[model samples]
Target chain A: MSRLELRHMRKAFGGLEVLADISLRVDAGEFVSILGPSGAGKSTLFQLLTGAEHGEGEMFFDGAPLDDHGRHFAFMPQRDALMPWRRILDNTTLGLEVQGLGRKAARTRVAPLFAEFGLAGFERHFPAQLSGGMRQRAALLRTVVQERDMLLLDEPFGALDALTRAAMQRWLEQMWRHHRWTALLITHDVREAVFLSDRIYVLSARPARVVREIQVPLPRPRDPTSAATRQAGVLEAEILDILLNLQPTKGHDHD
Target chain B: MASSSFNPRQLAGFLAQAAPAVISIGLVLVAWELYANHSGIKPTVLPAPSRVFEQAMLNRDALLDNAIPTIRATLIGFACSLSAAFALSMLVDFFQPLRRALFPVFIVSQTLPLVAIAPLVVLWFGFGLTPKIMLVALVTFFPMLVALVQGYEATEVEIGQMLRAMGAGRWRVFILARLPSALPYFFAGLRISITYAVVGAIFAEYAGAAKGLGIYMLNAKNNFRPDLVLAAVGVSAALTLVLFGLTVVLQRLAMPWERAAGRRAARKGPQA
Candidate 1:
């Protein structure tokens, strides 16, 4: 079990500030979501979390200052980002391979999870052969197989069709329950945040600050049409109202 | 499409595609024969195709002996150059400063005339296999090295980032991402280099060689046997065609995706 905490995270690119004093926390085994409008510097925040880009912030994992960014977290970029030349099994084993696992051992480790990820027959297939949904599953498998302290997902399901995205979100929720791993997802999809996260942090546009923190009062095993899901929807609407109000004012301020 | 069976329609289509080139070549040969018969020029100056063919048949033993050395030199030189180019490209890919330093040198080296250098090589190395191999290696190295460097650069940025995010080291990223991506480009360069390999071998031999098509041509020209010279030329062309075909076959075997992609594109038609 791993809990993640960020304090007063600030980022700037040249003179254009992207993130400003953003703070958030995720308890052990909890799923948290960052929902913001497009170009709200969510990617910038992810880059900071993954140590791809440096930002002025204090990050802690389970009460320890998060150092050695390489080993601590698994990062899934916005795209599937699987190696096109590799077979699905090989791609899935990449994280393990990077961690100095031998070919035979990595293969042994990942072979069983292919079926669990709905990719059993596709172990030998290349990335291009799979659908968008399957590719994301493989990408997720590649991320999760590493068994890192936390998973950072950047728009993992944003590219999928609505139905596929819904199914993947459900699948992800099921996996989350099974593993109980801490996950921080960056997304622009309010419904997705409402459906999958225990808490959602809504950010304003550029120089993004956490404007609202909404605890999802809805219970688990949320059906798409159930009262709990509707309650989550009400929360989603409330967040949407905040965003709609902020956009015009934010646009005027930018100019 | 079955490998075991021959379809008549397919055979007809193949013949139809080949007919135009065959007919044009036949016409050229006929015209040359007519000119040779009527112009009253010495056969030594401009031997007809028939005489060249006859000379080739008559001198088969000597031609084969000479042809073997030329083929051997070309193959050896090409292999050496391929290995060297691959190593250099990998180095350039690994070291950022090396690319900055080496790319200009690579471009400059390509501009050096083989004619001016071949004699100097022959002078330095003597009339043995060494000069011939060096010339071929020099001529074949540039295209493949450039192709490989460009291919390395062409690796998808997102994929590389993803690998890095997974905690891959520089060498691992290259082995996993860059090398495989560079293959198609390497083969493209191989096609150019393979053609140059034969020509380079013959030119080096021309400067001075004990045996090979270059030596055979020199002897034939000195003996005023234009037909024999043309026959040697024919053999060199055949060797080049054979090597080029081999490269194509090897490329197809190595990159099945290229063929599959082509078929997929054909099926999908054009995209807007």
Candidate 2:
């Protein structure tokens, strides 16, 4: 069964529609990326999928309709927004603590993952003590430690420098491979989308609609410097052309 | 290596910072002592530092009795103000409409000169600790409340959003994020309020009380013993300093991070 399905999803803010009739599906352990220009409603779609906002749509997780009472999905926001006052370990364990797990149990669960994510010795360090890349890694650890089957990441590496971002992408790919999560990521960087996804969904400008869904034929555990990465580049250029060529609707130039 | 161990330059820098205040106070005492000796100025008109020190020693028992009442009033009033202000701030934060409705009232109350109301408070509550305590609460509550509300509002939006994304509820966000962020603000307000607590207590005592430094000052003034009045004033100044120092200590305890940061900056010295 597919882990998540979004059907005919539509969203509007006042009179401005952000997403229009968007639909997608993710099978278990599949990785999908939504690529678009800045205001292409990529984030709006993530918000909708995570139930952060209400919209006109039908969303199913594990063949079950998304309801207010259900609590199976986790959303990771764009920014590395760890609480400044909390140590990295406490911040990572916050989700489990909220779910009524005691501190000791949550720490035990997070301890091994800290080493896996290269954050073992820094558990007692507060957010201000960590560098930006380390902070993002801690944020990612927090998201993954929730033990959810599906992860919705919105521009997780968008704020990092190019070199750090490249390193993080490879690290993320390894983590995903190890854990086999059904993941959906939103990004404006076409290269990032192509590098990390099994399939890329191209979104038009807001009131966004999915214009194309391109399946990436690149093999798993992909190297960014290889010929396969070059092929993905060609695919990214094609998606870029579609994004740039898209024109504003009549009298809707405010977008 | 020995020269570096006892660098004259570093010793000179430390002394340079301490020189002005120390010299100015020394000059003032010398001038006062000289004028009192040469001008035939009676000790009643202006107590020499020597006389005030002697008086302080002589009347230690009486001073202690009065100090106890003022200290009690200040502490009780400060505690009441902190609790009341924190609770009100939380209430205002939870309900925007209530904040909107009551915020103007809070501002107006603050604008009413506290000195004008201190007498009226004594009239209502009588010339006891009750009036003094009430006056201090009135003076301290508004600043603490304002600081707390602003602190709560100042929580970083991105941080709040991140916690929410983790499926953490409102109370969890507050306990983990909002409360810790507000500690610095709370301590800042407490510092301001601490100074006011002493002043407000003194003002209330001045308006009607039978004892306290304020009452002592009044009696010394009537008796034309300026030296005693100056001595009382010095005690009050000392009390304010003690209270302010207490706040700094509390700040250190509550936020060792700030103290560590301060030490780091000091060690780094001036950046060129």
Candidate 3:
């Protein structure tokens, strides 16, 4: 079992404060989403978590203070970040290869995952050969194949068209239901957060602080077509409202 | 991506694109022939196209003999430079101090006056193959080093970050992201260096060599046989074109993925 707890994490870039007294928890087997407006320092938080950037924070992993870089989370960027030169198969196996697994061994481990990721025939194809949605799936396959403690997906579906985004959202939900990996997703899309998350953390605009945490009680295999799914719409609206109406608390700053 | 299989349609398309270049070259040759026939210039100073052709045919064996050495020097020198660039670039990528020290030196190497250095190189090394090879290596090294450095730096920041986040070490990140991104740049640099490789070797041979196209041209010049000199020049130009074509083919072989991308862009270009 793996759990992540961020306690009073604060970050400043010179004189500009980014993460102002941020704290959140994602228990084991939980699928959490951090919903925020664009430029709300949503990405900066993930950057810190992935050790790409350093900031003042207390990140506890399974009740231990986090120090190791790659032990806890596998990261997926806003873009697919698939190496254009490598075939889709090699791209998916990249994480394993980086983890010191031999190329053949890594390939073998991730071979079956390509089919599950809806990329059966694209193994030999380059990143440019595939469509945007296919590339994202390959990237997701790359992330999950690492078999890390959790996944930190930063705007995974942010680059797709609306129709493709919806389809990928459904596809991702099905995959998540099957594996049940502890995951934290950072996104500006309220609809995406509502559809994919078990719980959503809303953040204010510039100097991001958790304004509220909303639990989505939508049951497993959420029927996007069902009348009961209106509950999701309500939650989507509520989070959207929080995001849309968020005012920069400049007066409360430096307190 | 396996462009190995040929088709009639592709051949037709290629020929269509190649038609203009062939026509332009043919027109230039025809115009030169007409001028040589009418100008009534001394053959020693300006041999007609026909005379140059006749001399080339008659001296084909000698030309071939001289050509082999020049080709060998060019290939060997280019290869040495490539390997050195690869080794040095790896060191530069890893060590900040090495990069800081060597980068300015590399630029200075490019700016060095080869005209003044060539005679000095011959004087030190004697009229053997060593100085010729050295000049060729020195001339070709900098483009590749610059290409490799720029290519490594141009790699997407997120790609490196994502790899490190996956527990990739510095070496792994390099081979995965940095190295591949540098391939296009490397090939572009290679194309530039390769063109100069042939020229550099010839320049070295001209400075001093027992047997080469450069020596052949010098002898022909002193003998008042301008037709022979033109024939040697023609041979060298043909050799350079062949080398340039080979680089393009090598680039294709190295990066089939870029070809795939190009095809996709081509297909989408009209509609988009």
Candidate 4:
């Protein structure tokens, strides 16, 4: 189990700041989500968290400062980013292979997860042969195989169709319940944040700062037909209202 | 997968596809022979196709002797060029400053005329196999080098970033992503370079050689035997065709995914 804390994180590119005073926390075995406007520098926050880009911040894991970011967290970027030349099995084993694992051993470990990930018969198929949903599932498998303490998922379902995205969200929650790895998801989908997360962080537009943090009291297995689902809807509306109210101030900030 | 017998329908379809080109060549040959016999043109100027074939058959032993040196020189030179280009491209890709400094030099080297340089190479290296090999390597290196470097550069940036996020190093990113992505470009360069290899070898030999098709052509030209010269030309053309076909086969074997994707595209319109 691992806990992550970010305190007063700030990042800029050249003269333009993208993340301003953004702070959040993820307790051990918790699922947290970040919701924001379309161009609110959510990706910059991810880059900072993963050490892909540098930022000014205090980041702690398990009560100790994290000098390095990527070593302890598995990251899934917005795009599936599967290597077209590699087979699905090989692609799924990429993270492990990067960590100095042998090819044969990595293959052995990843070969069984194909069926769990809904990719049983496609071990030999290339990325171009799979549909978008399958590619995302393969990418997810690649991320999970690394066995990191935390997972950084950046808009993992942003490109999926609505129906497929909803299905994948349910499937993801089931996997999260089983594995219970600490996860921080960056997304603009309020309903997705409300449905999957134990807590949600909402950010304002560019040079984003955390405007609100909401605890979701909804129960697990949040079936859309349950009272919990109705509660999620109310919470989504409240978050939407906060974002709508923030828009005028966001425009003035830009000025 | 190995079968002694082919599907008869498949065989018939292939024959049907090739029939027109075969017929056209046959007709041109017959017409050339007839015109040459009727018009009483000098064989030294434009030998009839039948006379050229007969000359080739009569001097088969002599033709084979010279063909050996040309073939040897061409294969050795092409192999050298391919290795050099691959090493140079990989080095340039690994070192950013080297790319800026060396790529322009490679491009500039290609603009020099082979005709002017071939003789100078022969003068420096003498009438041995060294000059012929050097000429061939010089002429065929550029296309492959450009293709390989551009292929390396064209690696999908998002994939590289994702790998980096997963803790992959610079060399690991190159091995797992850039190398595989560059294969198609490498084959494209190979096809372009192959057509030049034989011609470069012949030019090298033309400048100076103890034995080769180029020397045979020169001897025939001096003796005023245009038929023999045409026969040597025919042999070199055949050699080029064989090499080109080999590269295509290599491409097919190296990229089975491309073939599968192509078949899928054909079945379902274009992939988005």
Candidate 5:
């Protein structure tokens, strides 16, 4: 059975529909990427999946329907979104802290992860002290530390420079493989979608629908610079063409 | 770069910035002294700074005797104002309807000139500490309320979403996210309110009081003791400076991050 199922999910902001009749199933430990252009409702779909907004949908997690009071997924937004006042360690352990875990216990659990993530000495440093790449790593650590089966990431590496972004993608893939997590990533970068995802769901413009789902048959332990990885580049171009065609006319576009 | 050598240019720059204010104050004091001598102004009419200092020395015991009561009142009034304003701000933040209903009333209360209302407060509460404390709370509350509301409202949507995604409740979000972000605003409001606290207490004392700087000024006026009045004025100015200085100290302690940013800016020198 799939770990997460979104059946006919629909979301509208007043008269404007953002996600329309989107249905998909994510199996346990599957990595899926929702790719589209800007304002293509990829983030909106992530929001809907994670219950960021109430929408018409049937969402089941681990074969159980998600109730109003229960949470089954950890969500990481496009930005780092770290609490500026909190120390790096405290920020990473916030999810557990909110779950009624004592500070000592939460810190105990997060201590090893800090060393694993290359954040050992900077545990006491606040978010402002960290560089952009480090901040994103801390944010990812925060999401993962919650121990949720499904991780919903919205443009996680979209803000980084090209080199940093590539490094983060490789690091994230390593982390994902190590823990074997089910994740749904939203990104405007088609290459990112193809490289990171096992299967890619391409979303159309606002009032978005999944227009295409491309299965990535790339070999495991995918080397970013290898010729086999260049196959993913071909897939990226095809997705880009679809996204470009989906852009609305000037008069129809509204923020 | 590793050397800890002194920079003569930096010292000169510091002195250059301070020179104007120091010279301006000296000129003002000299002009006052000269005008008093030329006009044959009686010490009773408008005493020179020297005469004011002399009077301050002579009446040192008397000034201290009156100062204790006034200082006590000011401290009590300021404490009352701070607590009341904090609680009211929290209340306004917690409930939307209460905020909508009382915000306008608070604004309207501020517009009702304190000079006009001081006498009424004194009449209602008598010449005790109650009236003075109420007046200080009244004057200091609005700025703090406005500041706090704006600060609470300024919580970033991204941060709020992050907290929500972690399954944190509204109160949890507020306590963790909103409260810390609002610290600078609260400190700013406190700084502004500190000035108002001193003025409000003195104004209330002026309307009806037997002690305080305000009463001392009134007595000096009636007795034609201009030097004593000037001395009292100097004390009031000193009090304001002390309160403002305390705010700066509190802000530094509360927001080390801001101070770090400020130091960085200072090190960077002027930016075009």
Candidate 6:
């Protein structure tokens, strides 16, 4: 189990601020999302966490200060980032190999999960041979197979079509429920956040600030379109209202 | 590819792809054959295709004998050049200072005329296989080096970011991502250099050699037997095509996924 907390995190590139005094937390076995508009410095916060960039912050993991160079997170970029040359199975084992795990051993550990990841019989198929949804699934499998304590997913299914994206969202929730991995998803789609997360952090535009932390009291296996799930729709509208500036100014406002 | 069973459709598809090249070459050959017959330039000066064919048949043994040496030089020289290019590119890729220091020297090597350099090479090494192989290696090295460098640079930046996030080091990234991405470009460089390899070997022999197509052509030209010269020319061209075909086969064997990707694209159509 792993828990992550960030307090007053800030980042800037040269003179331009990207993340400004952002704060968030995720409990062990919880699924959380940072929902923001495109280019709202959401990825910058990830970069800070990954230690790929420097930022002013206090970050703690599992009740201890986060190590700047710890190998505790698995990242899935917006693109599948699948090597065009590697087959799906080999792609899934990439992280293991990078960490000095032998190829044969890594394959032994990863081959069984192909079925669970819905990639059965695709072990030898190149990424290009698979459909868009399958490729994204392969990418997700690659992320989780590392068995990292936390997952930092940046729009993993943003490239898929609407139907595929929605289907993937449901599939992701099923996987998260089964494995209960600590996951942090970065997305702009309010419905995706509402469907897949235990908590949602709505972020403002550039020089991003965490505007709201909303809890999801919905039951498991959520159906975002269900009439009974009126709360899901209400939360989506509220988040949209914040994003679109449909609400009047508040005390938290900064010029 | 080896696992696939026989398919006549494969042959037909191959023929379809070859059609444009065949048609263009056939049109040019027919025009040349007609012009050679009508123009009536002395056979000793510019032999007609028919006359050259007769000469080629008459001296087939000599042509084959000379061809062996040229082929040997081409093969050995190209192998050395490829190995050297691979090693140097790895060095350049791994070390920034070497890349900055050596890239300009690599480009300058290509600028030196092979004709000017070949004689000096033979004069230094003496009339032997050493000079021929060295000249060929020198001529074929730069294009491959450039291809590898460009291929390394062409890797997608996001891919590297993802790999770094995975805890992969510089060496692992090179082996897994950079090397695989460069295979297609390396094969392209091989095809380009191969044609030059044969020509370079012949030029090396022309400087001074006891055997090879170059020596054979020189003797034939001295005897005013342009037909034999042209026959040797034809043989060398044929040699280049054969070597080029070998590279294509090697490429297919090395990167089977490329063929698979093509098949997927074809099946999925343009929209995909």
Model 5 has an lDDT value of 0.82
- DockQ of predicted candidate 5: 0.34
Tens-digit per-residue lDDT, A189-244, candidate 2: 88888888898888888888888899988887888777786788888788887776
Question: Per-candidate DockQ versus the true complex?
Answer: 0.31, 0.27, 0.53, 0.44, 0.34, 0.49
Evaluate fnat for each of the predicted models and list the values in order: 0.38, 0.29, 0.70, 0.52, 0.40, 0.52
* lDDT tens digits by residue: candidate 6, A1-255: 348999999999999999987988998899999998888999888888887888998988887888844377899999999998888889999999998899999999999999988889989988888888888999999999998889999999899999989889999998999999999999999889989999999898888998889998888877665664787888888888888782334655634
DockQ ranking from best to worst? 3, 6, 4, 5, 1, 2
lDDT of 3 by residue, A46-159 (tens): 988988777887988988988896988899999999999998899999999888899999999999877788899878988887888988999999999999999999999998
State the lDDT of candidate 4 residue by residue for A122-209, as single tens digits. 8998888877788899999999999998899999999988988898898899889898889999999988999899999999888899
The true-versus-predicted C-alpha distance at residue B269 of model 6, in Å, is 9.6
Instruction: Please identify which of the two predictions, 3 or 5, would achieve the higher DockQ against the true structure.
Output: 3
Q: What is the lDDT of residue B212 in candidate 5?
A: 81
- Look at candidate 6 and tell me the lDDT of residue A184: 95
lDDT of 4 by residue, B157-253 (tens): 8788888888888898999889988998999999989989999999998888999999899989999999999999999888889999999989988
TM-score of chain A of each: 0.95, 0.94, 0.95, 0.95, 0.93, 0.94
Model 2: lDDT of residue A56: 94
Best model per DockQ: 3
Better lDDT candidate (1, 5):
1
lDDT of 6 by residue, B30-84 (tens): 8877887888867777767888999899999999999999999999999999999
Give model 6's DockQ, 2 decimals: 0.49
Position A189, candidate 2: lDDT:
87
In angstroms, give how far residue A253 of model 5 lies from its true place: 18
Cα misplacement distance, residue A82 of candidate 4 (Å): 1.8
Please give the range of 10 consecutive residues that has the lowest summed lDDT in model 1 chain A: A246-255
Report how far off residue A91 is in candidate 1 (Å): 1.6
